[model samples]
Target: MDSHVFQAVAAAAAALLLFLTYHSLAFVAGKKLPKGTRLPPGPPGKPFVGNLFDIPPEHSWLKFKQWSDLYGPLFRLNIAGRENYVVSSEKIANDLLRERGNLYSSREQLPAAAELLGDNLRPLFLPYGSLWRRTRKLMHQLTMPSAATTYQPTQVLESTRLLDDLIRAPQDYQKWFARYSSSVIFRLGFGKTMQDEDVLRRIMDVNHSLERVASPGSYLVDTFPSLMHLPDALAPFKRELKQLHEAELGLFRELLDDVKKQMDQNVAPHCWERTFIEQQESYDLTTDQGAYVIGTLFEAGSGTTTAALQSFVLAMVHHPEWMSKIQQEVDEVVGTSRLPEFEDMPSLPTVRAVIKETMRWRPVTAGGLPHQLVKDDVYNGFFLPAGTNIHPNQWAIHREPSLYPDPEVFNPDRWLDPSFPTFKEPLTVHPNIQNYSCFGFGRRICPGQNIAERSLNILVARIAWACDISKAKDEHGNYVDVPLYDYVSGFNTHPKPFQFYLKARSPHHAIIVRSALEKETQSDPLAGK
Candidate 1:
């Protein structure tokens, strides 16, 4: 053949190959529904890449909320041909994630989340099966409400340090919150307190990586898992994920090794790690499984607790009236002679209300972790296929105008109002309820809710009792502007670090805060002796 003919043939072959590759990249298993069945209403999409570009990479809950507003509470999105069903109402979420939990409790196996970052060992990403059940059982054994009291001394001790940190360097309040939250989780996971900021940074780094990888539409490979079959030389994302996996494994293993050493010396404090290890055989958990279980708990516990504390500060700075009311309630119940304790919780209804309001106002997990369906189901005449991703969007659910009047405002009075449909005891409510929706729902509801609430309650109560959280002032003595809705985007959202003025309420309060810290430093209160 002539040179011109050969070139034309080669070019045509390349064009055909490209077409096939593009078509293959968007392939997804088609769901065949029963006759006359229909999916929930959602925005229209194009062929092969349905709603692919429609899904935003960051702050998707906002987009989801907008869709819910337009398409009713239940809606469907077909992204890259994958089906995602979002639930925006408390009633629908409760009916599915709670009432029919067994059919909706499984998790999707995202490549970055389950295979690379966590080696399929993290319980949070585990599917609804024996492994998930075992891990959850182990978690319940350590974090049930009955088990929560055992960790109060640790929480109180760490919270005292948080109060001191606020008094010393109010501007770095975010770091103080992170430190306190991580310290508690570290002690719980490893039987040792986090001594340096480096560990917390490392933990945050892992969390950030996971958030990006696990989030829907973050990576093409996650959507079209066939891409994972590509060789390492061709897949750059996998290489990066491999590095993250190694780093996370190293950190978790080092922590576990330290706990094992302590256990060998019989000096290990009673903690989740020690307890899990001793009972591992009964749970049929491998060493790696045990380590990842504890590590994922730290991941789930620390970032959320830190985010909640940061939001609490924002709420107080934005709505000082509620803060004052809480402070007055705290003063009357506990006084300045001693910091507020767990036993004072019932008498300090305002403090409890503040905690509940903070969670509702600025949920850390705006869109709760996605739950996959185990079987095809119909709800109110709409067909939901098995393996659909279900997102119980807390942002939309919490802000439902019917349930919460003026939902955007930071008001705690709703909880106290008899006419309001608030959970009677927010702290004791099941995770599926409206008040506890921040934690999540169904079989996958956060097992650590009890301890997390305990931590938030103690810290919020103490901060209310001892400090005045207000907006910072400029050189001209004008209040510095703080946006009420400035938050970092992730699976676990947090107030983007902002300036706030946190001062001890009085010199006596300052002295008390310092004294408690000094005493805690001199002795290990977390030893639970």
Candidate 2:
């Protein structure tokens, strides 16, 4: 044989040996299980690659649900040698994320999400430790159920603006919703209403980028952490991610600095940012940490609230019967003399039910953020190793037929029916309900849920009370069919841009909306009178 051919064969053999040895060691290290233990059942996958190709970039929760049906409530997927345990059963989800939360509350380290998107600094993605604990404590203090009441005037004002926006340019209802949602968060977190269009655009752009990066399968570096070490020239993904991180950090810093400027002038309104800056030492947070803490609040509060309000609008357009019922309740409780207020929420159970149904009908985060196990654990005779990704599949859990009959239908009646198996009042709690799984579970449950629920309740109630939401009509005077399930897929699923016909229910309601706007514009704009 030629010397060159022999050399090439020898190099190939050496490379193969190295590959095998690395994988063998990795497998043994990950699976430090007792002899009788085994992983839960899952679909088969190819060697080396595992289920990398099987995981789609968008709407992955649907696929996970399908697998759960076939593989039973608990299943596993090996994505690029990473073990992902998906729990579709409510019982299993409760058992792991709630019952044994100490073991499963930490967040997994995603190179793209944590490092590139700068989410590692945010408590939402932080592991269960000092930083996370402090951040969460601060967030809880600001957004706890009682604390949420302090923001009622802002919510009421923004919701009234939402009503006026719908009455004026109903075609841009989605943008109006986005504006209202962002404005509320801005007021709460920064003590200022969102006035600069450019600032709003930048914040939304950052959120869109964050969503893509944080998604499970969008970045290969998340699956193959080793790739993070490659040089910029060879690993363009890393360079791009670094740029994204800088951009996000710059934005957060800019917002924080603006708040400081206001404080220096003694002109700043009461906001979370101002409070954070004042008590930074108490929270043991650096300047950067303080900025990201407030930034995370805006990021989480704005996008999710916007998506939820959009969902409520979509539900109204599709299910007019429920809309009419809710409207009737609002009219009976809050007459045309004025709009609905936060206090009216208790008397209007139907409106509250609609809010709950909207969340369940189409959850914003279909597959809740992945939780990481701090140590190897076993449940139901199955061994789940440390570092396993736990997915509490809210999409599947919310749609269980036994829990919600005709789960596909937008039925608010389920909450009102005493005979229904999982009926509960929507506004009775802060984080989640016994029947719903929208806010997530356990230690990492959304800390801003109380404020979010209040924001939704006021906006949804006011919208139902003041406007008539219906299908848009085409030039030919024919009703256009609004696709019920049309939504933009990402870490946060939102209704895609769609047309709807929104108009004041009566001239009296129109007058009330216009009067409220005029009064607010004339008096203290911040008061939202």
Candidate 3:
């Protein structure tokens, strides 16, 4: 054949190959969806790789909201070949997350997390099965309402340290808040005070690292799960995950070993780990089971509680007038000499509103951990296919103008409507805050919510009573502008670092703060002894 004939033949062969590939993809797409079933509206994109590249490098939540508006309340996005449905309305979220909760409780498998970091042991990622049930029950026993009262002293002591730290070095509010969270959990989980040198720092470091890796945007390996099967050397994230895994494991083991040693020596203070380990046989828990159960409790309870408290501080600093109002309420209820206690929680309406507003303003997990559907379901005639991941967009729901008027402004009054009935009102769910989505929704809601709320309530009340929190200003004495939206982009949207001012409300409050630190003996676990 001539050279021109050979070139023509090669061009024809290339065209045929492209046609085959397109036809194959078309066949797959056809089989993927049922006939006459319309997928939720979403950003238009290329075949088999829909809208994956459209997601922003940062503030993905903001991007998601814009897409949800352009599309409908229920919108779909394919990220790295996996399908995700962002539920933007409270009603839709309720139908899927609450009404059909059993089928929608399992988390999407994060391969990097499951294999590399989690050991498939973390409660948050546990499949919705017997294993998850057992683990959750254990957490509930330890953190539910009855159990929360037992943990009150730990909350008080830690918040005392927080108030003192804020008064002493207001500039380091972020670090102090992190430290407070670390210390609070340390006492509850390990029966050790974080006042031990560098203890809070070490714990905070581990938690911060875990937070970074656990978030949705942490690693490409999570987005493209096929990469998980690749060897450690070839995958860059594998090496990074290994380091994080080691750091996390080391810290967890050290705390566990300390608790074990204390138990062995009969010097163990009453802590979650010590209590559980002591009764492991009665609970039918294997040593590994006990370790993981306790570990999950430590991880889930600590990170979320810390994030909430940090958000509260950030909110108060940004909205000083609200802080003042809450402080006034605290003064009327509890007064200056005595710090507010857990018992005051129900009585202090303003304190409760502040807590609710903080959660509303910036929920810790704005786009909650995605729940994977186990079965095909239809809501209001909209088909929800199995294997689709669902995330309730709390940011959009809370900011809905119809649900919360003037949503941007920090106003707690919205919650205090006298005629606003409790659970009796169809519009309101969890009116007593017992089952607020802040903890989460349905059967898979956070088990540690009671303990967390008790801790938050006591801390916020006492902090407001003893200290005056305000924003730091520029050298010109002008109010320092704080980016209210300056949030660390992550699965859990905690406030990013910001400067703030916290001073004792009065000389009497200053005395209380100083005395609380120095006279730690009053808070000494062995006070009676």
lDDT of 2 by residue, 219-326 (tens): 867776766655465567888888888888998899888889989998888889888988988999888888888888888999999999888889988888888998
Name the runs in model 2 displaced over 4 angstroms.
1-32, 425-436, 525-529
**lDDT (Cα, tens digit) per residue for candidate 1, span 1-529:** 5788767765765565445445643543345667787779999987666787897888889999999999999999886656798999999998999899999999989997889778898899999999899888888898888888888888989999899888889988877888888888888777777775677778889878877777766777777776676657556888888899999998888878877898899887778888887888999989888888888888888888889888888888899999889899889989879999999886877787888888999998998788999898999988998778999999999999998999888778788766677646443332122228888887888988888888988998999988988899999999999998888877888888888888889999999988987887778844432
What TM-score does model 1 achieve against the real structure?
0.92
| Weakest ten-residue segment in model 2 by summed lDDT | 426-435
Model 2's C-alpha root-mean-square deviation from the true structure amounts to 4.2
Cα miss at 13, model 3 (Å)? 25
Ranking by lDDT: 1, 2, 3
Clashing pairs in 3: none
Candidate with better TM-score, 1 vs 2: 2
Q: Per-residue error at 299 for model 3, in Å?
A: 3.0
Off by over 4 Å in 3: 1-28, 32-37, 197-199, 282-286, 419-432, 517-520, 526-529
Question: Which predicted model would earn the best TM-score?
Answer: 2
Report lDDT (CA) for all predictions: 0.83, 0.83, 0.73
* Model 3 clash tally, residue pairs: 0
Candidates ranked, most accurate by TM-score first: 2, 1, 3
User: What TM-score fits each model?
Assistant: 0.92, 0.93, 0.88
